[model samples]
Target: MIHSLVFLNGFEREITVGNALVTSYFKCGCSSFGRQVFDEMLERNVVTWTAIISGLSQNELFEDSLRLFLKMRHGMVEPNFLTYLSSLMACSGLQALGEGRQIHGLVWKLGIQSDLCIESALMDMYSKCGSLEDAWRIFESAVELDEVSMTVILVGFAQNGFEEEAIQFFVKMVKAGTEVDPNMVSAVLGVFGVDTSLGLGKQIHSLVIKRSFGSNRFVGNGLINMYSKCGELQDSIKVFSKMPQRNSVSWNSMIAAFARHGDGFRALQLYEEMRQEGVEPTDVTFLSLLHACSHGGLVDKGMEFLKSMTEVFRISPRTEHYACVVDMLGRAGLLNEAKTFIEGLPMKPDVLICQALLGACSIHGNTEVGKYAAEQLFLLEPDNPVPHVLLANIYSSEGRWKERAWTIKRMKEIGVVKETGMSWIEIDKKVHSFVVEDKMHPQAVIIYGVLAGLFRLMKDEGYKPDKRFILYYLDQDVKHN
Candidate 1:
């Protein structure tokens, strides 16, 4: 109709009309049609350029989005904040950090760094690109922090394993009277994580109810995750039951939580329920199911699910799925079968799968397979100290002093020093950290005395140290010490 009208009115294509049509088509999910109109436009402006770039990005054609942005720049079209925003999103989707950095420099050159949308986009780009420090620096330097920017940085911290810091910032934001948006609330809830105190989870649950976000799908999902991760499976189920709407993520989370808690039967039941309700399972759903089988040692059920995923659901298994299968088999003492499984994998086995087998071998004391897995791991990820250290421990456990010494020598030669073990506990709002053989704490003497007393009590209660568990190369005096 537009083309007919143009023909009837003898109207030359106006840039504004062309831009509006392009945006409309793109927004309506017709990027190809939008491109057709765009190509026909004799006179294009920055709006036209931005429409195509942003549309491509929104449609997940990140490469095309970036290519168009570059072409716009080459055509001498000045980029607006939207153009930079779209380009940065493309970079983020592609994890093109170098290109993203170049765009950051352009933002400075364009003198639009103060624009809130641009600043928020920059923070998001940096966060998604795995530069939390840069994202936090932007957050700190911003004269005004809006809810969006605050949420972005909060999520960034939570995702990067800075849970304590993320929780701290959540407190600060609340104390500062920032309105707790649903995403912010979700981010704070995520900080509860796997070690969340039941008290903390209940507190957040109360907050969710009080804030009237109990019915929000995202908030409900977050609530379920928090409860599940904190080992309150009943509470998680309660939340799931009460949710007004549930998405794939909600179902997946519940399944994963059940699996993680070693309840494969219940997990399978939930999977069946989800299917009965016409909720199609995603790849993550199968992963969780496989994990349940692995943890519960349900090898037959796991094999059935793996087969169903490919044949019935038509979903191809990923490396994580394969790893789960290997773990399941290895944990069952099917060492030869697990090795054959890896060798027959459709694709090359990843380091994670090899590491899984290695860990299982160490647990089952299969030094032969452990050696093979450790060799594969060394080739796959030489920089990682875990494979080498685990292999050395396996050798030591088997009393292979020569192999253990060789492993140690190789580690030293490669400059791969394992970090000293450390553990920490938070008590009464304070964190106390301790390392192996550490004696630096103010109450170290008292702490060690208590530990020694507990050890004595255990011995008196018929506890005996397993001699076979001792490291083979330690002298008797050193072991006693």
Candidate 2:
């Protein structure tokens, strides 16, 4: 109708008609048409300038957006808060930290930092550019920080590994009588979950319950994750059950938690329950289920689930899914089948797939497959020590000492050394970690004395220490030491 009106009215109303067309094109995401209409406009106002700037930024033409900002200034149109906000966003998307700093200078010159929207946009820009320090400075300088500003700061801290700092700020926010929203709790709990601090996680759990935020799905999901990572599978299940509504994340969390605990049957049960509840499983959910099947040696079940993923769920299998299938087959001692499956994958095999085959070969004493896996793994990860060690072990087990020596020599020439494995256990909420023969702990002498006594007791009980458990480089004297 507007186009018809323009045609009926002819060139006398070209500017009016052109502006309408430009606005319509911009709204419909036809930026090229918008640009054409904009170019034909006889006179453009600040609104016209802003429309183009916003349209370019929205389309992610960040460089063009910045160029248009310069053009707006040259045309003597002063930028308002909206203009500055859009430009700052463009700078952030482009990761133009230097340009962002220049924009910050402009904000200061224009005295618009106190403008809430403009300041928030600046904070977002700095944070997104990986400059959290600048983000915090802007946040602190603000006379009145809103929920949006607080969320941004908390997110910045979380992303930067300042978990404790973020939690502290969250506590202060509550103390200041700020209303705690679901988003705030979710953000804080997310950091707690990643830290894997059970005590801290429990404290957050109690707070969520006290604040009556348990019903929030985001909060519930975070609680599930925290409990899972903290090794409290039962607690995770309890929290999951209490959720008023469950999404794919809640189901996946429970599934993965069971897998982590080596309760494959329980994990499978939960997967079935999740399906019965009509929650669609994502790729992550399937990955967790497949991992459980692998660990439990449920080869047929794993293959059935893999088939159902594409046929029943309509989710396309990614490389990760293929890797999981290969790992499952390999772990179950189906070496040839695993190799064939990997070869048939539409995607090229990765080092992890090769390493999985190598691990299986090591277990089955399949020298042929072990040698093949080792060569491929070595090419992919030349600096890693596992493939070399596995190959050398296979040679040593087969009485091929010369071959073992050559493998060790090659490892040394490449400067690859097997990393010593350490085990840790938490007692009284403090973690204690030790490697074999490590004597650095304050109670190392007492621990060694106790271990010697246990060894003697075990020997008297007709138990023998598996010599294979000892490092090859260690002799009798070193073992005693």
Candidate 3:
């Protein structure tokens, strides 16, 4: 095809045709061919540069796209909206916050910051790069915010764990008279995953129905996930049953919901139904099944799916799948088998896999194997404090005071301190965080009083605090006090 194009119009003269050929080749996934044509071009314009950069970004060749953008700047081609858009996308993919900020500066320098599409893309880039503050700044500076712009900001907020802020912004956008689209609704639904208020979820569901977006597959799937994560299995089932069309995501979500709730029989039944409906199971589908088997003690079923993943579906099990198997075995008290599985893995077991085994050993008071897993975790993630903490807990549970004391000493010697446990609640669009025994809240006295009252009532009702969680270094008198 290149030969034919070159034969018809000598490459140097037909810059337009050459640019078209580069774009066509890139669109066809022939990036090498596109580069060859781009290299052969004697007269490269902004369009040609933008075409290749956009193709590379869209195809997820982010580094190459950024490199070409650098070259384009050196080539003295001033970037327009398309160029900035593609480059910003590449920045997002690579999580290049510095480069994205530089591009934002370039946008201001070029006097194109007013371009809504470019502004939206900039917010998206900053959001994906973990600069939510910068993204919010871009959004606040926008003269006229569109639905796409609002949606990107909302998604950014959600992805960055600013759920309350995201929900507040959604409410603010609606109050400002911007028409909400399916994408925006989907983004809003994500907030519910973190904020597990059944009342709030149902209010959103009502809004979805009123807006006639109830039938949207994406929205439906989001509702299912939100409900499941919130521990409302019935609501998730309700959403799944009401969806007009069920995709693999919907099926997998419902299956996972049941599995997570410890109804492995129902989860397996749903998987069978999904297969009968000719909706193929994805990697996520198998993950949910394995999770159910692990939690529900259906180890045999989990093993069968692990084998069938490769043999029947021709889908290679990823590290996550293998980790699930290890978790299942460990949880079922098959500690030796789990260790053997890890040793025999085709790839190195990640720290999370070892952590799972270590956790299971802690629960079952298997000190010997737990110690080995903890040591492996120390090697895998030297700076991580979890293994050290968990190992100490395991020793404490088994009444091995000396070992627990040694573990604590080793943690201090290695300069590995456990992070303080913290919790947060979002109230009226504001998030308030508190650490253990926090006294920072304005109403801390009242809150503490209420908590003390609840603790007294719980003790009266036969609730007992587990003392094994306390550090063994502390004296028994101190612990009692």
Candidate 4:
């Protein structure tokens, strides 16, 4: 009607009307019309460019968004903060860091990088592009730190595998009296990823309720993830039952919660209920289902799920799904079957798949398969010491000290350092971390005394430590010394 009225009124060429048309076309998912309106306009301004660029971005046409933004740059029109933000969003979605950096240079030249939104977007783009150092630089140099920027940087840390730092940053935010917004709440919950962080997660849940984000579906989903990750299945179930609305993630997270808690049958039940409720299952949903089957030792169920994932859902199996199947077979002591499955895969086994098989082989003392897995791992991850260590453990378990020594010797020759084991205890809302044999804590003496007592009890209960693996430790000690 507007198009007709504008034509009737002969206001089609007017700047305001043309801008509206471009924006409206893109907003309505008519990129062709939006482009037609844009191209036909005799004159275009920053708003015109921003409308088309940002509109394309909002529609997830990231490539077109960047292209249009580039076109705008080549023209006489100068992009403002809004245009830069849209381009940044496109870059982030595509992880087009090189293009994003060029845009950053332009924004810096315009002297608008100090703007909070611009800073946050830039940081987000950098973080998503795997440039956490750049993101950190932006965060540190920001003129002011608001909760939104803080949240972005926090998520950046988490996404970049800096979960420990993310948690510490949250602690700093809380101490600084920064209000934990819903987004911040979710990010913090994500970084509280293991059962040890259950205390932290509960505290955040209370905050979520107080802030009235309990009803917010996004926050509700985060709460489910937090509870499930922290091994609070009952809490996750309670949260799921109370959700006002459930998205695909909500259902998937709940299914994964059951999978993680070893209730594979219930995970299957949740999946059926998700289907009954008319929610489409995503790739993650199937991954969760497969994980449930693996842990529940339902081999037939797992294979059926894997088949159904491709045949029924048409979802291509990811490397993780294959890894799950391998882990399942390994757990069930079907070493030969797992080996055959891996061999039949069209793609080369990734480190995840190899690691799973190697771990299983170690448990069952399958030296032959273990050696093959270790060889694959050696080719795949030349630097990762986990395969070397696990393979050596397997050798030691099989009474092959010479082979175990050879494995340790190979590690030394390759300069592959074993990753240090870390442990932590949360007391009085403070997480205290320790390394292997760490004696730096104030209560080191008492801690060691308690550990000694526990060791005696464990030994009495036939829970003896395999001192056979001491070869690797001895080498490690000598290397470090």
Candidate 5:
């Protein structure tokens, strides 16, 4: 159309005609063409400048968008709310914290901080840059915190591991009488993982039901995730059954919950059910299923499912899928096959994949593979101590004390200290974590006394000390002491 206009009509087009063509191109997402028209214009107004900047920003050319903003300033075009909003969005996309701060100052100087769109964009910018503190400050200082600002701040806190802060603001939002939408709940729930507080999660779940957000797929998925992480498999299943709609995430969550609980059979059953229900399994779903198979030692079942991932589902196996296959093979004591599989992988095996093989080697006492895996893992993550520890354990089990000592010496030289294993149990909403020989607890003395009495009773019943329980440092004198 522009070519026809130039060839038949003339090269000399009216400013209004050029602007209309540019606007049409910008609307059609042809920012480059709009920019060409913009360059050809003899007189560029504020609207013309804003249109191009907005177009560039929308197209994700953030730096170019920002550069255009600078050009608008050089041309003495006074920016309006739309100009600032577009620039702020560019800053948010690029996570340009310094530029965003400059924009904040400009907004303040222009006395447009109270403008909802500008303020919301500022909040989103800070949040996207991981500056939750700044996001919260803007949110609190806003004359009116709309749902967009509130949800952005809430999600920012949650994603940054400030779960407590997120929940607090959530309550305050409720008290201030802001309507909580499913999107807000979904954003908050996305950050709730295996380590989140179950009680707090339950409160969120109850709120979802009370607010009638339970019917929302996002809310339902959040509930499924929260229940799964809380170790409430039954509740997770209940939520799954009641969900009016189920996405791949819902199925994956249930499969993951069962896998985590070591109920591989049930996980497999659900996988099959998911197929029967016509909900296709995703990569994550297969990963969870593979984990279940590995843990339950279902070698044949695991292999079949792994094959189905590529053949039946037509999903290309990624590094994570390969890692699971290696883990499953290693865990089942198919050491040679595991090594061959890793070597045969199109992509290089990552440290986690190698570490999985090392763990299996430790359990099966395969010193050869364990040593090789340890070497590879050490090269990948020199600071990690697990590979060294596993290697030491393998040598010790094989009665190769000299090799074990050498491994420990190398670890010491590298300043790698084995982290003591700790287990935690949540009781009555409080978590209690303990390490072996931990004497810092108030009830440590009483717990030791009970253990001593139990040991005595076991000794009287012809029980003997399992040398496996003793640390390498524990000698006769230490045991007596």
Candidate 6:
């Protein structure tokens, strides 16, 4: 009604009314109308642009947001700090590292300083773009460190496989008297895996209750994620049910928890419940739904959801979504169909598709498909040791020792190296790290001797270990071609 009134009165031509209308429309989730109001405006300023750009980003229309930012610059309008911050967020959401770097350069050149929101957005962009080195540099160079910035960088480290680094930094925040924040708790919890997060998550849950943060939607979502990561599906459900409010993230989190716990039917039920409550499912929700179907061996159902995502929700499938469909087929032992699907992609296959196909091929002993997948990986990421290692394993299983030798040899000739794999275990209230192999442990010989005995016994009893789990030590040598 108010929108109609504005249209009837021609009030959208006023700058303040137009800006507020745009921002309010986006906040109310009527983005199409927000866009219409924005386009009808006769005058636009920095605030107007910021409102529209930020609204576009908030509505998950990231590419449009950045396009408008570029257009704004081309029109000789200077973007203020809020504009840059919103643009950085769009870059982060899109994972457009190149554009994000350009924005960073422009910000530095324009002397935008001491704005924590922009600093955090910068860190988020670099981190989400998979450049933790740049994120750390930005964090260190900051003139100030606050709770929000620290939380962003901590999340960067945790999500980018720097779990140990993230944990150490979380300790620093505690020592510096940083108050507990939803983001901080979530990031710290994310630094651990499987059983590692449970104890800390519980402690944090207690702290959240003590501080009256239990009702916070963000924290509630974090708890759901934390419980799911720890494999405590029941606990996650309990938390989800207790929340007085739920957003799309809340629903998606619970659904993902069900998917992670191998309860595809319950995940579907929750998805149904979400839709019945008039809550719209986002791409992440579908990712979980597809994952549930994939792992549950519901290939036909997975295909249906894949179609529904784009058709019903009007979401364009991302690389990850394509990867899931391939994963669905691959996990169901439909190697030929998986390959065909990849061939039919509108875009070139990415690392996720290659990795999924390679793993599936390994499981099913589809040597030809495995070789093709590994070759694609070699071309796409030459320095990556995973394809070389996994392909060599495929060769080893087929008694094609020459091909295996060539694969590993090519890896060495190109100076490719693999990070040392690590595993941990807890027993009798103590944790042990055993990835040191023969290097650091005082009783390495004894441990290996015992392990060898166990393997011998298991083999004698007709038990065989999965060959995919074994990582052979790389011996360096040159290769032909």
Report the number of the highest-lDDT candidate.
4
Task: Go through the candidates in order and give each one's C-alpha lDDT.
Answer: 0.85, 0.81, 0.86, 0.89, 0.83, 0.85
Shift of residue 155 alpha carbon in model 5, Å: 2.5
RMSD of 1: 3.4
> Residues 39-111, candidate 6, lDDT per residue (tens digit)?
8887899999999999999999999999999999998678998899999999999999999999998988987
Per-residue CA lDDT of candidate 3, range 1-481, in tens?
6658676666545888878888988899988888888888888788989998998998899999999999888878877789999999999999999999898899899899889999899999989988898889989988988889989999999889898788778777778877888889889887775445556677778889889998899999999988898778998998899888989999999998998899999999999999999999889999999999999888898999999988899888887888889889999999999999999988888987899999888877788889889989999999999999888888888878899999999999999989998776756645567777788899898988887778677768876556457533112343453
Q: For candidate 4, write residues 173-204 as lDDT tens digits.
A: 88888878888888877776763467777877
lDDT value for candidate 4? 0.89
lDDT score, candidate 5, position 176: 81
TM-scores for all predictions: 0.88, 0.73, 0.84, 0.87, 0.76, 0.76
Q: Give the residue spans of candidate 1 off by over 4 A.
A: 1-21, 28-30, 40-43, 195-199, 422-433, 438-447, 460-481
Evaluated with TM-score, which candidate comes out highest?
A: 1
Pitting candidate 1 against candidate 3, the one with the higher lDDT is 3
In model 5, the Cα lDDT at residue 430 comes to 59
Between prediction 2 and prediction 4, which has the larger lDDT?
4
Q: In terms of TM-score, how similar is model 4 to the real structure?
A: 0.87
- What digit string (tens of lDDT, one per residue) describes model 1 on residues 1-481? 7756865776647888888888888888988988898999999989999999999999888999999898888887888889999999999888888989999999998888878888888888888888999999988889887889989998888877888898888878778888888888887787776544556567767877888989888888888888887668998999999999999999998999899899999999999999999999999999999999999999999999999999999999999999999999998899889999999999998998999999888877789999999989988988888788888778767778788889888989999988786676656545577877778999998988887778677768876554334232212443443
Each prediction's RMSD to truth: 3.4, 5.5, 4.4, 4.2, 5.2, 5.6
Cα lDDT of model 2 by residue, 339-379, tens digit: 88987887777887888888777766677888988988888
